[model samples]
Target chain A: MRSILNITDLSLEELDQLIATAEDMIADPKKYSEVCRGKKLATLFFEPSTRTRLSFEAAMLELGGSVLGFSEASSSSAAKGESVADTTRVVGCYADIIAMRHPKEGAPVVAARKAGVPVINAGDGGHNHPTQTLADLLTIWRNRHTFEGLTIGMCGDLKFGRTVHSLVGAMARYAGVKFVFISPEELKIPQYVITDELEPRNIPYKEVTTMEEVMPELDVLYMTRVQGERFFNEADYIRLRDTYILTPEKLTTAKEDLIIMHPLPRVNEISVKVDDDPRACYFQQVLNGKFMRAALIMKLLEVNV
Target chain B: MIIGQIKDGIVLDHITAGRGMDIYKILELDKLDCTVALIERAVSPKMGRKDIIKIDQAMDIDFDVLGYIDPGITVNTIRDGEVVERRQMALPERVVGVLKCKNPRCITSVEQELTQEFKLTDRKNQVYRCIYCDHKASK
Candidate 1:
């Protein structure tokens, strides 16, 4: 009935229900395809994100529902001088459920307020991206069977990584989960994340400049690329270009069972040689994303689990 | 050692020395055409060393921006050689218009028509973040 503004909006009880429902969908896919046969999903992506937009579409299609809307703002009326409220008011007429992605931080919050139906935040500007965090949780649960008692090494650009921030916030809610942040000083995790979430929760963590030192101890290695265009000086980007590269040589020291995940469209951060290895679960993570979305769509649409 | 008697004006004391230019830029003091006395290196017990700006005819001063930039400032509202309202600088709740967000792709910055709004979160450190963009305030 309300908007999916942030991951915190979903209570722990609801999270459990979603997890159970997703697990049910995973076990039996065909049993609930026609559950929401006539509903509609409208994806309003103001930015370019082929993977997430595709996953949302696939999720809707798998439920025997339909998908409508634009992957970019140019194709939509937003290229005009229309406000977010006006756009959502228009989109609300056609959509049964709205999933919006915007470059502005609170654009979805504004959209959700105007939307006639449920609004899911696909991504927001350097802010919370709840659904991706959902997929991440689902992926972790599916593989490891639990969220706690693990050291997750989030390497690369932690300062600008929205997914990493959301994941850190979500994991702090669990028990016995420690974090090993591997990033150069220029791209270290923001101070607010440590002060507001990790330290306050009494969650133990270590900040390291290199990945190789902590690679063996990590249960999961979540990689995100350093955004070069954000740097005011090109030299700063050059200085920390290869602070973390998931090459096979580095993995020789890592545990055989250590799972690797990336919010994809990866650059040279992940070497191609690691793709052939079974532990490289980024593509599998993508598949898992679709399943997670399918399960999410069904539950959100009031389809039977 | 500079001295001026205030008949009807506000004397903003305890500002950071050499930060008067930034404050002037932020408030657009010259455009407003108010009589001002810009003082630097004023000595006070609280600030040991400070600066002050006296606006002769400014009806409304944004104490919020003053506090946000530097909490050490003291504001004195005077009328007829009598101090009307005087207090230390306090954090502003809602800053109506301020600097643009650091994010170039942000809706506020790109949209052009929308005025930027920022909430003052950290008062002591003067951390102001845009409400819509979540971009850090750029000095």
Candidate 2:
């Protein structure tokens, strides 16, 4: 069975198809409303998540499917020391598909190996989050209509932001996609990402400390929160928390056609006033997330038409 | 000078000097009932100095571990005190249950039952990343 453990799980053709399907879903939501009827989705979240968990639940619910499973580890068999493989094996018997978010990296991979049903990694501890990338792709497609020759600026906490990593990996596959990585020295994008993903592929990229210098040239400005939860040292987190806040003044230098994005539940990385700007596409990105997820469920379930 | 000769066994030769003890511990040579000899800092024209291990029993050895520790190792099989098969070692594509992934968030770190696995992603750089978390295995 096919499962999305990472963004690379979907090929370029598949990604294009998914994006097209998402656009279709947005155009006629009622047509695909009952596509997943009589199906079941199990959300096995072993970590605290608001947007991702709710996004999955909402996507499944809107598709005429039932949703089950816990939102945290304490409420599940995991609290009793049950393994991810064991938990997924049991959940597989009950659900048609599984969306799992765990604190442990590659927990979904463990589940995917054991579970009879298809497993979608919701977010596996600072690892891949393919669905969010799908949403991001759809948002980018809706705005720019193409991935070619686009300057994508990713700002703040590139090291710990799994979204940035996944997005970089996905976008690097496209033609003429340039990246401007803006982050503090301590939070620069991982070296393997540069060496394995970019350097070998010969993708052009520039790493900088400030976002404002490259803001005007970008087609998409992805703002990520500098999360304290991901930091081991509290003092380091406090020092870098406000390193790249996207204020109204900064947006003035950005292109008029620039699309500002954030994987919401954002904490001060993006100023609240930026929400009113015509370029702010994050809310639209959230809606696209639902659409993309619905399309993804259809694709994974092999629901025809 | 010949330290010892094995009738029917395996010989690990050309191990980088000072790494013989590491290989000994890794291969658990101490647990073997058969005779095992470790020659450390042996003079070598090519390597300047090298380590060699002669096992008196032909047993299953982990070539991947040998490859990971030092790809320069050469293996020789002895049959009736005659060197029959000679093998050169290179880095394995994937290693299982050898080096533990150091990433705290890696699933292998938490899942005690899971065997730590790493894939040699970059052969040129000798970079091995945890198969589960993509955390680079520090040499």
Candidate 3:
């Protein structure tokens, strides 16, 4: 059974295939609508994530598949202190596939091992969120037409942003892609990502503090929220939250075709004024998220149009 | 340092000095009923000084633990007071339940029944990342 626990789990070929499938779904939604007819999807969200849960549910619904399962741990068997593995095994019998979101990192990994059916990791704490990266990739593909040679600038909380890490790792596989990490010193990209992902692969990248310094050079400016939940200290979160707010003024130096992306439910990082900017694609990223998820669901389910 | 020879047991030789205690503690050899010897800072011509652990009874040894704690330690199987077989330790590709992931958000932290597993990602640096959260195992 195929399970997507991390973005790295999908090879470049598989990623391309999923992207192609998403594009096809976009081209003719009615053709692929009932491909998963009579199938069931169990959404075992051990935490509260309305957007992700809705995205998964909508994807299944669009695929003509029925959706089952809980939204939070309090509603699920997890509240009774049942293990993820146990719940997954039980749910596998009821649903053809599972999309799980948990507050604890690698909780879906446990579920995947026990699940007889394919398990999709929606989000796992501040860890791998492969589908978000899928959405980001689709957005990039739609905007830039290729992953090669794009100077991508990632700003805000690079350290704790799993989407940034996953996206960086995914994009590193493509040829000639450059990364510009723009974040405060405290929220700088993790060292392991530099040493392990970028350095080893000879992917050229630079770390900078100011967004304006690298604004004009980027083909993609990936903005991320400084998540308050990720920070242990509320004061630290408060101090760093407003570090890199992307305003329309900031994008004056940016490329006219520059794609502004964010794994959504964003708070104030990208100003409301920037939403009117033709370059802003964060909302488009949300719609792309649904399509990519539908593609991912079909792939993991081994369904055909 | 005079230590009694084992009749039928396993001998761990050439452990990097100062890590014998770590090996002992991690292996939980102190709980063993049989005679277990941990010789520290013993003179070695090749290594300047080394640690050796000798177990007086044949038991299932975790070679992965031995390899991870200190690689290149020689394992000698003593049968009737004679070394019957000798094996050399090397870095294991994967280790389970040997190291605990320190990442608080990791699934292993909340799920006590789950095995703590790590895979060797960088061989030259000897870096093992948690299989669950990809957190680097603390040395």
Please give the lDDT score at residue A111 for candidate 3. 90
Better of 1 and 2 by DockQ: 2
Ranking by DockQ: 3, 2, 1
Tens digit of per-residue lDDT, candidate 3, span B3-25: 98899999999999999999899
Better of 1 and 3 by TM-score: 3
Q: List the residue pairs that clash in candidate 3.
A: none
Q: Mind giving the per-residue lDDT tens digits that candidate 2 earns over B1-139?
A: 7777789999999999999999999999999999999999999999999999999999998899899999999999999999899999999999998888899999988897987889999999899998788899986
Range of the 10 consecutive residues with the lowest summed lDDT in candidate 1 chain B: B105-114
Q: Tens digits of per-residue lDDT for model 2 on A162-269?
A: 999999999999989999999999999998899989998899999999987888899999999898888999999999998889989998888889989998778888
**Of candidates 3 and 1, the better by lDDT:** 3
Per residue, candidate 1 scores C-alpha lDDT tens digits across A164-184 of 998898888999999999998
Top candidate when judged by lDDT against the true structure: 3
> Whose lDDT is higher: candidate 2's or candidate 3's?
3
TM-score of model number 3: 0.96
TM-score of chain B of each: 0.84, 0.94, 0.92
Error of 1 at A76 (Å): 2.8
